[model samples]
Target chain A: MSLAPSERPGTHPDDSNLSATYALVLVVEVIVILGLYWIGRQFG
Target chain B: MQWIDWAIVAVYLFWIVWTGLRMGRKTEELESYFLANRSLPWWAVGLSVMATQLSAITLVGTTGQGYNAGLSFIQFYFGLPLAMIILSLTVVPLFRRANIYTAYEYLERRFDSKTRLFTSLLFLLSRAMATGVVIAAPSVILSVIFGWNLTLTILAFGIPTIFYTMKGGVQAVTWADVKQMVVIVGGLSAAAVALIMGLPDDVTVGAALRTAGAVGKMQALDFTFDTSTTYTFWSGLIGGLFLSMSYFGCDQSQVQRYLTAKSVDEARGSLLMSAFWKIPLQVLVLMVGVLMFVFFLFNQGPILFKNTYLPAVQSSTRAAEYAGLDREYAQAFENRKLAARAMAAAQADGAPAGAASFARSEFVRNDTAVREVRAKATALVKDVTGDPDYNDTNYVFPTFVTEHLPVGLVGLIIAAIFAAAMSTIAAELSSLATSSVIDIYRRHLKPEADDAHYVTVSKWATLFWGLFACFVATFAAEMGSLIEAVNVLGSYFYGSILGVFILALGVKRANGDGAFVGLIAGMSAVWWVDQHTATVYLWLNVVGAVVVTVVGTIVSLLTGGATAGPDAGKSAATRAA
Candidate 1:
């Protein structure tokens, strides 16, 4: 018998919504890293 | 170390082991043992995911990388968040819907048992070999710091980790990992803060950064189109993406982490957690090392951080020569300190660009002379020890921890190091046992075993792999060349393994025969590139996955596609004859 998926704590949104959010998250992170790089270059 | 520090470490170990054992008491079936009944919350699994990736070497070594070479090393993780998003959309839901115990089990449903067994064996072999290095790495620090026997050190780390993982299974491993993540992060955060506060009064935070920036330590981006550079933006994004994809998508250790989450959404959330926090976390750890670099400028830093060869240098025929070099190093260090102070003052004044520029060049000249003296000392020590590549990057953080950090904090950081080591080893041991049972024993050795029987066998598998890791680690201490060979050989297989997964997921035309052949071709291509070209190692993953998919798809098309749908073969039930 397959173990049933337990009820989630409702903390996370659905996968479709979360997937898009994560994609956005990655884009934001890349920007942050780039910002850090530019700032480091300026101070450097 | 002080008694207070020893007390903190001892208490932490006791609590961690007890908590792990307590969590495992209810794990009576394979589902509970391996997947935590798919009932774990997203946050627990998320922290475990982070903890598993933040191994001891990463904690110590990456910080050392920050100290030695600036934040350019952070680029190595540029692909990680992207990889996580891809896995979230693709493999996370795919594995959840299939309801498989191991990732290779899904390969069997899509391909054939031979494909399943071949890939699983690769996982077992590579992971088992890598686990040895994982345990050996921190044990080296313990041995040096505590003056303990290396074999005993191996056992000290391996034995408790083995027992808890063997008894508690994934539940124990996951919970222990969550707690470990806390300690690891807390210790690192505390260390970073302390290092900043510990800096001399004259060197303001901005000044320290300017000092670091002036030395090219803070330069994080390199936009050069050169393929030969190790940590370029392109290499990190492309190469790191491929490596992260294979690791998160295909490798059972990581696959198993997300699989334990309550639902596909939670699994994706766990990975997303890593994606969001990983770069910033890396920057913080690297910042600690950068701050340490500034701390050493004003303080009298060691000429050679690894002091193992001090007695030998003092007693050797070249003792006076070493002493003269030490005196020269002191003079250069003082000159560099004055130059650094001048540069910091000039930068604050907004004076003509040439003043700061001159101070920077003067500081650099003195710094280069000091490094030259240290290089000569390193060579002399290497000659005395007869180990050619005796660099001390790994020793730098531990040396700093002992010498500088306050008493209770030192113990806390040391415990965090142990936590990092245990968390990784636990996850590895858990996944190794899972693959061994789900992919091999149940599929081949005994397909009809009852739940109790399989669970018992799973425990035995965990114990066996744990012992095996310890065995390899013991020998690894004696044979350095073998460890290198094992690491190189492991890298050779990852791209091929990742390739087969890509075929399984993306290429509908791929049959068992095509995938099997494509895997071999991919391995061959990677080996060929490694032997013939100067292509950086990160690119090998991309090449391997692409070669497998292209070759496998071509072969499948040439052989005529889709004779059957999903149930392509049932010979997986039969043993190889």
Candidate 2:
């Protein structure tokens, strides 16, 4: 698997990009959590 | 408890200790003692990470939650995978490259000794107290079931874990955790299967699921944005992310688990493993509780799940009142069971489904009446015992196991509980020792000590903290629910710790004094909100982290930016020290 340019060893993102990463992951997690909520509603 | 069950538990205890001890010979230095020589594979570290987080609270208290409230409590974990990903991209790489024995050691490199010591002490305080509660929870069930005293139960589980952790160090904790995770998963799976099998032959799994759903026990999500509520989807995802970040990123107990990996990528892999498995695992554990709820529908469950309280109420002056309530509860149970069976039959017969819906409503009414009577019985038991805050949610699964499960399976479940408790307690003891010695003893008091001397001191620290945890366990029974108490206790400090770390890692101008005062400010803000507002505890993590970062940044600017130097403390001497 190819590594993201920012994800390679010794190549961390700058402060702005790192902050963006945090926001991006948060949005992704919230979406997945909503998916879990969907599963519970459907199966429950 | 049967002899066969006792024998299974005994063998499990012996096997874990032996496995731990066999790894002890690998520890020849401080690095090896704490990080397993950084030679561990990602999968082993991943399993250990998962096991350490899946404590007795998850096994017992969470299942109790499922039985009491349903799958809604699972929203509390929605932030975990996100937190794991964040940690993988950020702190895991930072800590691995820093070559530190404890996460707080990196704080010193970034800020100052005072900052490191303060955050490290906070971790020691919260984790040490939480460990007591962790060990206390399962011991309550074991003592009640086996007729042993609580102290004896605590020690029986505590001593071996402390011994193995002190002797074998991280290597032992890691491998033991791997096996313990397997045992925990297997044991819970067995109990789930047993519960389904124990249901009347006519009640198929799908029928049981429908029955559970009909009673509102299956609704797992709540999107309503209510700050006062505890387990809504928003609170779980946002607040839970902050909690998970504090726990997996900043807490040494969890951070140390992943730090044993061979490289930064491996460490990240270890956390991602948790991201993938944690929610599914929690779903299964809570499913066991949901299944138990279904099982008890056909069976006659006790008026109070806590049997100790039953005896107390029986012997109290309110015995006649209690006896009356008990009869009512039994009758209600019968009515509820018949209604549930009728609903199942109607659904199977391809009727209009109206009759099934009516029967569901009738069953719910009877179940509600039974619960009201049980509440009165609990109140009476509390008055007689002079113990307020008595809740029996933690006792639900354990009582079902002891009273209902087949003999061999009972032992396996009990053994799994032991594994769950021991895995968490061992990790706490080991991490407590690491921070105490690496962050305090070696860094401050004995900075020039040889590796042999530091290793010996670390072992002694483990024993001291182990004893401290046992003492704390004695008072833990009064706490309402073990899982909530531990998490609430964590929320009190975790946000502030995470805030301090964020300042250390993300903000270039953040100085030690700023980090220090900001942490206190963050904690005080959380305490104020906890006391004065109706905000749920999960949000406290977010509150604390934000308070720390904002307060720390403002304080830093006021104090003349970056007191140590331009690059903070990342000098060759400090980095290589």
Clashes of 2: 0
lDDT (10s digit) by residue, model 1, range B424-520: 9999999999999888888788988777898899999999999999998887766657667776776688878888988877776777788888999
lDDT of 1 at B202: 67
Clashing pairs in 1: none
lDDT of 2 at B542: 92
- Chain A, candidate 2, TM-score of 0.55
Candidate 1 residue spans exceeding 4 A from truth: A1-15, B311-315, B350-353, B481-483, B562-577
The predictions' CA RMSDs to the true structure, in order, are: 4.1, 4.0
User: TM-scores, in order shown?
Assistant: 0.94, 0.93
Worst 10 residues of 2 chain B by lDDT: B565-574
- Model 2, B1-577: lDDT tens digits are 8899989999999999999999767787998999998889999999999999999978998998988888888889888888887777778887877677888877766677888888898899889999998888888778986779888899987999999999999999999999999899999999988988988988888778777877778888898999899999889889999999999999999999988999877887788787777887888888899999998989888888877776666777888988898898888888888887876676686677488778777777877877788788888888888878777888899889998998899999999999999999999999999999988888779879788998899899999999999888877854556546666767889989999988876777888888999999999999999989999998999999999999999999899877652224354345445
